[model samples]
Target: MPYVSMSALLAFVLVYGLGLGPIPFFIASEMFEVAPRPAGMAWGSLANWGGNFLVGMGFPTMRNVIGPYSFLLFSAFTMGLFLFTKFYFPETRGKTPTQVAQLCSRGLRSRPLTTATAKHIL
Candidate 1:
């Protein structure tokens, strides 16, 4: 297997640090109602920490077994998420929480899965 250089690792970390790391927290906070926002944020934080722990614990074994190809698993998952968000996620800009929720519900119910109603989330 080919060795991945430190530059590639740095690039991944940089990209994640720039956008992926902070944006989810903002999005999670924006996504919930005032009444449930605290609980939602807590759950989101838990999931984030849990996922981090899983990767921290499992990455060594996965890397040892799969070598550089271990990165491919994450790349594929990230790509899927990108596509899902691009298509299914809504535009919440300038909207109230209730409006956002209603928009999401309408999109889910009336629109075809293949069609993206939201202009862009990213």
Candidate 2:
């Protein structure tokens, strides 16, 4: 690839990866009914870092094992996970703790909160 093309590819990957990567954990926190507390936040952060570390630590071996096409598979899996979350995860905002817990536990789909839901909850 040309220099400009390479730069564009790099930028695209950076933006795309950063934008969609954290979503799984954001959904997980809701799905798991993690309380909005310091400890909960700490646990979430720990989980995120742990995953990051595991991937980073294994990247070289994975790259060698899978070759250049590994990233394509990785991206595909990431997008699949995102789509799965979008379809299955319940929105948690504006819900009481009990409601959130129930939604998470029962897998009951709640419509995502709008301004009206925010107003009602507030």
Instruction: Tell me the spans in candidate 1 whose CA falls farther than 4 Å from its real position.
Output: 1-15, 104-122
| Sequence-dependent TM-score of model 1 | 0.70
- Candidate 1 least-lDDT 10 residues: 113-122
The top-ranked prediction according to TM-score is 1
After the best TM-score superposition of candidate 2, give how far the Cα of residue 36 lies from its true spot, in angstroms: 4.9
Considering every candidate listed, which one attains the maximal lDDT? Answer: 1
Which tens-of-lDDT digit does each residue in 67-122 have in candidate 1?
A: 98998988898799777775567878999998876776665433354324343432
User: Could you tell me which 10 consecutive residues in candidate 2 have the lowest summed lDDT?
Assistant: 29-38
Candidate 1 clash figure, as a count: 0
The per-residue C-alpha lDDT of model 2 at residue 15 equals 86
Report, for all candidates in order, the number of backbone clashes.
0, 0
